[model samples]
Target: MGEMSDTGRLVLLGAPLGNSADASARFREVLATADVVAAEDTRRLTRLARDLDVTVPGRIISYFEGNEERRTPELVDVLAAGYLVALVTDGGMPSVSDPGYRLVRAALDAGVPVTAAPGPSAVTTALALSGLPSDRFCFEGFLPRTPAARRSRLRALAAEARTLVLFEAPHRIGAALADLAAAFGPDRPAALCRELTKTYEEVVRRPLGELARWAAEEEPRGEITLVVGGAPEVAAERPDDDTLRAAVAAREAAGLTRRDAITEVAAEFGLRRREVYTVVHA
Candidate 1:
């Protein structure tokens, strides 16, 4: 294990999403010698270290969602003192929709060197294995849990053109898929990747309706990542100039700022902002 680097550094280590073999060699070295190993769960980290047969020589601290705000400042102080700090979560990359963002931000403010030890990531893995469009996609993380909130959120994203990736729990999978089908159309192509890269892994690819039906029978174990096809592109509309202007006017009347109203109207009419603003304002 090497001593802390002269320069204060923040290393974001990507722990194995699953399977110890997926862990990068650099990850092992960093865990062995970093001045501080801040993990989401120290117990889990210890188990992982044992799994890889690597000893973590540094102080192991818990840095999870509940305590991230309180722990960040202290970790920043350590980093400022030229200590090497490694951030790891229970799985995959740190700070990618995880609890490492707070520490990363603190390190950035302290001018600590920030780097990543990339390894397995469920987001990209699910996308790649889903047979969906990978060239362009978006990560929406987890949707709202409440039915009303989730439905509204889904409706807002219903017209999204790029493929969407989401993380959801096993218990909520049924409702989530039902909401997706209702909002984005039952026929939308999608893949439900459960326990990716682990034993008992399953990928169900079909219409959202089919996935919902499958989930109704039995819930899969482990983490779940959903990849849904984007909304189909509709042809451009050629509404009359008066109708466009009226739409913007209506939005403004409904308490939207001029800029905000224009954005909403532009999407509705499938017109560019510049085009909508020019036509509406003119």
Candidate 2:
């Protein structure tokens, strides 16, 4: 930890999701002042800097999937030399289905302090805009590219109870939706958000089947994000008195007030709050 100040730090930059205005003040500052900037697409980085009207005074280098393995150690060497290196992807955060994981891992392995100026993510954006329950959801990122592999993946996820979020290229949206419908059932509720936070941003909410047809008809363009509702949960049998008391006690031990614990336990157990209170107080 003490090496933080002594060693060069790795900054993970979250590029604007779609709007140049989404760039944070610190995001621009890092771009302008870092000793080196590692970008997935240096061309996109240049375009983004032009959009933001921010002149990057630092040296920029390509650090993408193709060369990530070879580039990681080189960046770590820069960090060892006490030069701040900021990493930026084409969009969103450096890594959440994007490159940067390898570099981050390598940096940490070398005891370099790493941090992020977090930015917008399509996973949560589509989930929030989808109107699906976000309290407990899963991000599946991009599914398999092939029909057989994609369907197999969806089949494995069919019984997942948490809301599922995924990304698909515009060209593959129709086929992906079709595979999703076939795997998860046609009636499953889903949403397709495209060109997020941009001039033509659009979100379409429909069942998996309808989304498939919509994609076929519209041939939606631009980046695509999909959020799907999870499978319905089967109700569990009610637990006994000791079990209820332990559940309440666990929440209270975890820093919840007794009242909040009761409320949460009741919601989970499908009981009135009064029932949990009675069990707790009893």
Candidate 3:
């Protein structure tokens, strides 16, 4: 167990996503020594520490979604008292779509030193196993639960050029994949990584449409991390200047305003509205 400095520190420890062996030595050391251990799930944290042969002698407090708002200020106060305070979620880093953001923010505001013992992350793990373009990618967390909102969100990301990483519940995986296929187009390539770094782990890489079909037939289980390929580098078919102009002219002749004509033409050709406007005005 390491000793806390005169000035307290707020340490955010990254709990292992699945395998217990992934827990770092620093994680064990902090668990053994921190004055206050705030965990998303106390049971899960205890089990993890036990599996690592580490004992958490400090006070343990539940700091999950239900109590985070109420608990954050108290934890921050502990940090201000020159005691080392450690925060850990059920899995992964504290605040990546998890419950540690508020506590971290409060600690920083209260002038409590904030640090992290970074370890396993489902996001980066899935991305590495995804075999997708990881150079430029974004973590979308989880999609909206409602069908309308989920589809709307996917539609908004239809033109995203960077790879996308998302988390989804096992039961909702099928519907989400179906919605993704509808919004991003069936042919878009994607990888579905489920139960990563644990027993019964599965990674399925296929086109969105095919994956959706598979999910429909076979129910997926356990935690899910989806890595989807971005929109194509070049559209399969792009209308030439003459074709775009002709389409715009036809729409205008059919009683559509110039703006409406350009909008319609651009959507039809998968071209940007600004690009269509340029062509139409030219």
Per-model TM-score versus the true fold: 0.84, 0.82, 0.83
lDDT tens readout by residue for model 1, 23-68 = 9999999998898999999999999999999988889999999999
Model 2 per-residue lDDT tens digits across residues 62-151: 999999998888889989988899999988988799998998898999999999988888887888899989999999889889888988
Instruction: Give the per-residue lDDT of model 3 (tens digit) for 136-221.
Output: 99899999999999999999999999999999998899999999999999999999999888988899999999999999998889
Choose 1 or 2, whichever is better by TM-score: 1
- Which residue runs of candidate 3 sit more than 4 Å off their true CA positions? 1-5, 235-282
Please rank every candidate by TM-score, starting with the best: 1, 3, 2
| Highest-TM-score candidate | 1
Each model's backbone clash number = 0, 0, 0
The residue-level lDDT of candidate 3 at 149 comes to: 95
- Candidate 2, poorest ten consecutive residues by summed lDDT: 1-10
lDDT of 2 at 136: 98
> lDDT for model 2, on a 0 to 1 scale?
0.90
Judged by lDDT relative to the true structure, which candidate is superior, 1 or 3? Answer: 3
Clash-forming residue pairs, model 1: none
Error of 1 at 115 (Å): 0.6
Provide the overall lDDT of each model, using Cα atoms, as 2-decimal numbers.
0.90, 0.90, 0.91
Task: Give candidate 2 regions above 4 Å deviation.
Answer: 1-5, 236-282
